[model samples]
Target: MSRNRTRFLKEFPKAISDENAAVFIGAGVSVGAGYPSWKELLREIGDELGVKSDDVYDLAALAQWSVSDTGGATRIRQVIRDQIAVDHDIPAPLNILARMPIRHLWTTNYDRLIERALLAIRRPCSVISAQGDLALKVTAGAARVYKMHGTVDQLDEIVISTDDYELFRSRRGAFLPLLQAHLSSFSMLFLGLSFTDPNLRHVLSLIRESFTDAPPAHFAIVRPPQKGDFRSAEEFEARLAQHNLWAKDLQRYGLFAIEIEDYDEVPGLLAEVERRVARNRVWISGSWPLDEATTPEVSFVHDVAERVGGVVGSSGLTLVSGSGLLVGSGSMSGFLSSLQKTGAWDLERRLIVRPFPQPIEGGEPDRAQWDLLRAELARLAGHVVFIGGLKAEAGALVDSSGVHAERAIAQAKGAYLLPIGATGGAAATIAAELIGSDLRFDGPDALRPSDEQLASLGDASVGAAELANRVLKILKSRML
Candidate 1:
C-alpha cells in the first residue's frame, strides 16, 4: 500500500469509532449505478442545441442554453427525470457505502441512488433536500443524507443551469450553513467527486472564510488521469500535472487527496475501512467431542484461550465466541476466570458470547439455529481462530466445527483466520487445507503461516503458550 493509503487505514478506524466520520459523495458514484456524468448530461443537452458535445466545457451554461431555447424548464426536467431517475439495483460500491456506520452523508447528486442503497441494506435514512427537512427531528438509528444539489424527486429545486448556480446562496437558504457545520464537526471522506464542481468550490470557500484555523482534516478519493486514455503521453502528463496542482490547492480547505489508479479500487478500500474499524473483535470457534477428549487436546484449548483472554483483556480487544457446550463454553469460561484473577474482567467490553438458541426442554440446538449463530459470529468478528475438534464423526461428510470455520471464512470475506493444526482433529484438517490450497490470506505475507509451520502444527508437543504467541504475533503485525 502507498503511504497515504496506510495512513488512511490506520486513522479512519478511530474516526468511525468516535462517530466523527462522514461521507461526501459526488456524481462519479452515481454514474456507476447507471446515471450519466455531469459532462455527459450537459453534452447530450448541448448536442440537441447543435453544439458539439466535446466543445462544451461549462455544463451549467449549456444547461442554461437548453432551458432558454425551450423557453421553460419542462424539457430539462423531463430529460433529468428520464436520465437521472434510475430504478435499478444498487451496485457493490454503493452497497458498501450503505453499510458504513457513518450517520451523515452529503451528496451533490440529484438522483436517489444513495437513498436507495441505504434502503437496500435496511439502513433507514432521512433525506434532506430542502432546508425544512433539516428542521425535522432526526430518527434514531437512521442516517442523514443531505442532497446539496437537490434530488430528482423535486425538479424545480434541483441545482442545475448557470442561473441556479449564480442564485445558490439565496435559493438554498440555510443549507449552506448546515453544510458548513458538518464540515467543521466531522472528519469527512470525499468520494466520487472532482474538486472542480462550482457548487462544491463555493461551499469550501464559505467554510474557509468561517474558520480562522484549519477545520477537521478531510479526505478526497481522486483517480489520477490515466496515461492510456489520453490521445498522447504529453496530454496525459499535462492532465496529471493539473490534477496535482488541484490537489495541492485543496489543502487550503483542509482536504487531503487519496490518489488511486482507478475507480474500481474504491469499493475494496471502503470494505477494508469497514474491516479495520471492527478489528478489535476476535471470534473463537471449535468443538471437541466431550466423550472422547484427549488430555493434550483439552489442555491445549484451555491454554490457548487463557493466553488469548489475557492478551485481549490487557489490550482491550473483545472476545466474541459461541456458547457451544464443548469447546465454546469450556474454553471461554476458563478464559474469563483468568481475566478475573488479573483484574481485567469487564463484561461490557472484554467479552461477548453469541449463544446458539436452544430448545426449551434442553437438547442440542436445531440445525437452523446453529447455522444462524455461526453466521452471526462470522459477521461480528474481524478475526477467527479455530482450535481442535473432530474431523468427522462416523459417516458424516465433515465435522460440524470444520464446517462452521469454513462458513466463517467465507462469510467474513476479509477476516483473518488462524487454524492451529498442532491441536489436531478438525483444526488440523483446516490448517492442512489452507496451507495446501492456493488461496491468499488478506494481510502481510509474514503474518500468514508458512508451509513448514503448517506441517509442524499437527505435532502433539506444541504447548498453549507457543500457539498463543503465534496468534498474537499475527495480530500485532497487522496493527503495525
Candidate 2:
C-alpha cells in the first residue's frame, strides 16, 4: 500500500472511534444500487428535447431546459419520481459502511438508500431532509443522515434545477452554516462524492472565507480519468490533466483525494477500516450450565469471566456478549462495577449485551437463528475470549455448542482467540490446541501471547485475576 493509503487505513478508524469523523455521500454511491444518476435522470428529458447526453456538460441546466420546454415542472417531477422508483439489492460497499459506528451521514442524493442500509444493519437513523428536520434529533440511539439536496419522498422540495443551486442559501439557509460547522469540527470522508456540485462549491468558498486558517483534514475517493473514458485520445488526455489539477486543488481545502482502479475495490478498503476500528472491541462467548449444583470448575470459570469482564470494561474496551446462562451475569456485573467505580455513564455506548432468544415450541433451540446472531456479534470484535462453556441438557452438564460455533465464526473472521484452559469444559480443548496443536491467535508479534502466559492460563496455580491480567496485556498491546 502507498503511504497515504496506509496512513488513512490506520487513522480514519481512530477518527471514527473518537467521534470526530463523518461521511459525505454522493449520487455515485446510490448508482451502484440501481438508482438513476444525474445523467440518467435527465436522459429522458433529453430524449424528448432531441438532445444527447454526450453533448451536455451541465445536467442541472438540462433539467431547467426541460422544465422551460414543457412550460411546467410536472413532467420533470414525474420523470424524477419514475427514475427514483427503481430500486435493487443493497450493494456490498453500503453494507460494510452500515456495520461501522458512524454518527453523521451526509448525502446529496435523493434516495433513502443510506438510511435503508443502516436500518438493514439494525441501526435506526434520524434523517434531516429539510431545515425543520434538523431539530428533530434521535437522542436515544440513532445516527443522523443529512439529505442536503432533499429526498424522493418529498418531490416538491427536491433540489435539481439551476435556480435551486443559485438560490440554495436563501431557500434552505440553515444547511450551509451547519455544514461549515461540521467541516470545521469533524474529518469528513467523501465517498463517491465530488466537489464540482454548485452547492458544494458555494459552501467551499464560504468555508474558505469563514476560516482564516486551513480547515480540518478531509478526504475523497475518486476515480481518476482514464485513457478509454472518452473516445477521443486528446479529450482523455485533457481530462486526465484536469483530474491531476483537481487533485492538487483539493488540498487547498485540506481534502485528500484517493484514486482507485475500480469501484469493486471499495468494499475491501472499507473492510480494512472496519477491521482497524474493531480491534479494541472484545466479544465474550461462553455459557454455564445451571443443572444440579455448581461445581468447583464452574465456580472457577465464573470467577475468571467476571475478572475478564472487569479488565475489559476498565481498560476502555467495548464488551459484546450474549446473555448466556450463569456466566453472562458475572461478566455483566464486573463490567458494570468497573463503570461505577470510574463514574462513567455511557453504558449504552460502551456495551452491546444481546440476550440469546429462548427456544419456542420445540424443546431444542433453533441453531440457525442462534448462528446468525453469533455471527453478527462476532463481526464487531477483533478478539474472542471463551470461558465456562457448558450447558444443561437432559438434566446433565455438556459442552456448549454455542461456544464452539462462536469459535468457528470468530476464527473465520480472523479474530485473536483467548480461551482459558483452566476453566475446562469446551474452552479446555480449544486452549490445548493453542499450546501444542495449532497457533490460532491472529495478532502482531508484540501482542502475541507468550508461552509463559499460555502455560499460566492452563496452570492450576494461576488465579482468576492473574489470568485476566494476562489477557488484558495482549489486548492493550495493540494500543501500544
Candidate 3:
C-alpha cells in the first residue's frame, strides 16, 4: 500500500503537469466544509419519518423511503434545505485542490464549496450543474466543474429518490456518458467518494466492460478501516477484509487506492503533491533597468540570465518569466532558443509569462496587492533565481524590494533559492544574507544547496555559463 501510495504521489502530479488530470469529488469533501455526510443526512430524514437510520444499509434507498412517505420530493427537499443551509468555510484540502493545475472537477455534492474555492483563487470556472448546461462550451484554460447530481438550489430536481437514480440517464440526458468519457480518457483522482453510487458504479462497470487489460490509470485517497470503528474483533476483521477487497476491486477498474490512517492527513498529502508538481518550474526573481546601465557587469548579468533560461528549457524544466526590462527579454530569448534547438519553438509551451497588474487606479502602487500577486506566482515555482535586482532611485541604484519579497515568499512555499550573487544588487544582498544566516540551508542534507556551488553563485568572477551549469546541477540534485 505504501508503494502504491508512493507511486501515486510521484506520478499523479505528472498527469497534472501534462494537462491530462481530472478530479472527482464526493460528499466526504463537503463533510469537511461543515456539511452532513450521507449517514448524517439520512439520520435527519430518518428522524422525520419515525425511522431509524441505522436500520438501513443502502443510503439512496433510505433517501427514497423518505421521498415515498412525503408523497413527493417536497418534504425531503425541505429537510435537505434545512439540514445543510449554513454558510461553510472552504476547507484547507479544497483550497489546495483549487490551486493545483487541474482544470476539471466532477462532484456529486450539491454545495458550492468547490466553486467558492476556485473563485477564491480567481480561476474562471464554467459549471455544468444540470442537463441544460451540457450545451455550454468550456472556455480555454477555464476550470470546468460538473455537478452530476442536481444542486441544492434546484431542490425539485435533486437526485435523492430511487426513481431519480433509475431515470438519471434519461432525465439528466448524457451525464452518464459524459462522465464515462472523462473517466475513460483522463487520469482522475477520486476524492472522498464511497464508490457506492449506482451511477458512478455504472460508469466504472462500462469502463471495465470495455477494457483491453490496460485501462486509463486513476487514483483514490481512502481511509483504511479502523479497528476502533467496529464493535468486536471479528467485526473489525471482516470490515478490514471487506475494505481490502473493495480496494482490490477498484484496481480491477483501474483506480489504485492510497489509504491514509486518518482523514486529517489529506491536506498534508495534497500539499506534498503540490510541492512535487511545483518542482522543475523555475521562477526567476529580480528586475533591472537594462536601458539605464551600460556597465560590463550589467552585460554579464544579462548573459547569465539568458544562459540559465536556456539550460532550464533544455533540461525540460519550465521558465516562469518576470517582466523586468532586459533580464526578461534575455531569458525569454534564451528559453526560445532552447525550444528552437529541439525543433519546438512554442514559447507558450516552455515559458510562462504572468504579468502583474501595475499601480492601483486611484492611489499609489498597491504594495499589498503586489505582494499577493508575487506570492501567488511564487507558489507555482519549485525554485527562485535572483540576479541583478536593482532599481534606479534618485539617480542611484537601490535594492529592489520586490526581489526580496519574492525570496521570502518562495522560502515559505518551499521553493529552492538559486541566487546569482555575482550580478550584485538585491540578489547579492540576498545571497549574503542567506549564507550568513544559513536560513535556506537549514533543511535536510540531500535537499540542501551545495556549499562549494553556493559560494560560486556569489563570486563576482564566476562565468555565466558555469553559473548556469551550476544552477542545473543544483536543480537536478533535488529532483525526487
Candidate 4:
C-alpha cells in the first residue's frame, strides 16, 4: 500500500473502534460539495443587499443591517437550500465521507451537503437545524447527521448577528449539553473547520467552561501553521490546547492536507475512506454475549435495530438464547445464577438459559436431561433461545433438538425475534449495508431501558440499571 493509504488504514481502525466517533464538519467540507465558500456566500448576500462582500463578512454586522432590510439569515438560507437541492453532482468532501464508519456527524455549515451526500448514498439521516421546530433530543438515537448551525433554509436560526451571537453565548446552556455529551463520550473528528468562525469559537469556549472537571477529548483538522501568513503551528496548538481542544498534526497522523485545486479530488479521497470501512467489518456491542468474549471482539448489536428497521419479517420474533438471558441482567449473573435457580422461576415466555453442567465425570447424555431442559424453554411458550457461540460445545444438543441455531432470528419464520446480543449496535450498521439504508440512532436516549430500571437508567455509563435498559430495548423491539 502507498504511504497515504497505509496511514489512512491505520487510523481507519481507530475511528471504527470508537462507538461514539463523530465527524465534525465545517464550511470547508461543504466547499467540496459545491457549496459556496464563506467569502463567496458573503458576496452573494452583499449583492442582494446592495453591499460589498467585505461589508457582510461579519455575521453580526450583517444581522445588524437585517433590522432595516427585508430579511436577514432567512434569505441567505433560501439561496443555499435552492442551490444544494438542485445540484446533481456528488460533492468531493461527501464522497470522501462515504468510506468512513462514522456514526454521527456534527456540522456548523448551514448547507445540506451532508444530507445530500447521505441521500446520494441512499442512507436515511436526520437534519437538525436551529430554525426547525424539531429539537435535538428527538434525534438522540439517530445515527446519521446532526446540523448544529441552522440550515440554509432556516436562516433565522443561524447565529450570525452580534446580538444573536451574544444570545447564543448566554443561552449556551440549551445546546451546549448536546455538544458536551458528544465530546465527553465520543471521539470527535473535525473536518473543514476554521478558527475564525464565532459560532465555532463560542462552542469551543462553552465546552471548556462546562467540562472544567477534566479536559474532554476531541480531534480536529487544522492548517499546519506556516511561518508567514498564519501563526506558527505551536501557537495555534496552544490556543486550542487552552480550550482543551487537542489539535492534530494531520501530516503526522498520515492525513494529507492538499489544496483542492480542482474540487474533483474530493470525491476520490472520500471514496477511499468509504472503501476501507466497507471492507472492514465493524463490530457493535452492548448486549451480554459481547461481554462473553474473554478478549475484544467486533460485535454488532447496539446499532442494528434502526439499521434493519424496514426489512420484512424482521420484527416480532421472540428470540430466546443465552444472549437474551445475559442481556436483561446487564451481566452474566442472572443467566449464571438462574441456571441453578432451582424449583421454578417465572421466565414468563420466550426465554432461554445455559444448560446445567454435568456434576459427575464421563456421564452419558440422557433423556432426563432432555426433559428438564425442554421444560424450561416451554415456560416461554416453547420459544427457546440459544447462543450462536454454542455450536462447538452444544452441537449434540442442537442436533438432537433439530434447531438451526446459527440462523438469525430475523431469518426464522413467523417467530417474533428479539436478538439478545450487541443490542443490535454493529448489527444495525450491517443491516444498513444489506438493506442499503442509513437509518440509525445518534444518542443514548433512543436506547430505551425497561420499566424495571428506566428511572435509574438516566445516563450512567454502566451499572445494573444501564444493563437492564439495554436488555429491555432488545426485548421490546421484538414486540414492535
Q: Estimate each model's TM-score.
A: 0.75, 0.89, 0.90, 0.46
Pairs with backbone N, CA or C atoms under 3 Å apart (clashes), candidate 3? none
Model 3's C-alpha root-mean-square deviation from the true structure amounts to 3.0
Tens digit per residue, CA lDDT, model 1, 1-480: 266667777777667755778888877787777777777776667778999755766777888898899997788888899888768667777788777668899888898888899987678989999767778987786999999778999998898889988888888867877777878888888888674454566666776865647577788888878888689999889888988898877777777788888888898888878777656677777766665555665666656656665555555566778766666775576567667777865665447798777577546658776666677567666667677666445744245564555444544565666677776666777787778566555444232456665655456566776666666766665652
Candidate 1 structure lDDT: 0.72
Better of 1 and 3 by lDDT: 3
- Runs in model 2 deviating more than 4 A are 47-51, 137-139, 195-203, 206-216, 291-294, 358-368, 392-397, 435-453
**Can you write out model 3's per-residue Cα lDDT over 1-480, one digit (the tens) per residue?**
787789897788877776778998877788877898777777878888787876666777878887788787777788788876666999998899999878889988888888889999889888888898888877777888988887776777677778887888789856767777777778889888654443456456655755555556789898877889778999889878877888888888888899888889999999888888888688877788655668887888889889988988888887896666767777877888898899866565457787665565565776777887788778888888888898888888899887888888888877878788888889888777666555545343222365566688877675899888888888876654
lDDT of each: 0.72, 0.77, 0.79, 0.43
Residue 78 CA displacement from its true place in model 3, Å: 1.7
Which segments of candidate 4 are over 4 A away from where they belong? 1-12, 47-51, 55-57, 69-85, 96-99, 131-141, 169-173, 196-198, 210-217, 223-480
lDDT of 2 at 283: 84
Compose the digit string of candidate 2's lDDT tens values, residues 1-480. 155576677678887877788998876788778887677777888999899855687877888888789887788889888878556688888788788888888888888788889888778888888878877756566888888888888887788888778777787878878877888888788888654443456545755654537566777777777776688999989888877897778778777777787888888888878877778788877887666335777677778889998998899888888877666778887888899889985686678887888876558777788888888887888778888687778877777877988888887886777787777767776776666545634445222255566677776467898888888887888742
Clash statistics: count for each candidate:
2, 0, 0, 46
Q: Is candidate 2 or candidate 4 better by lDDT?
A: 2
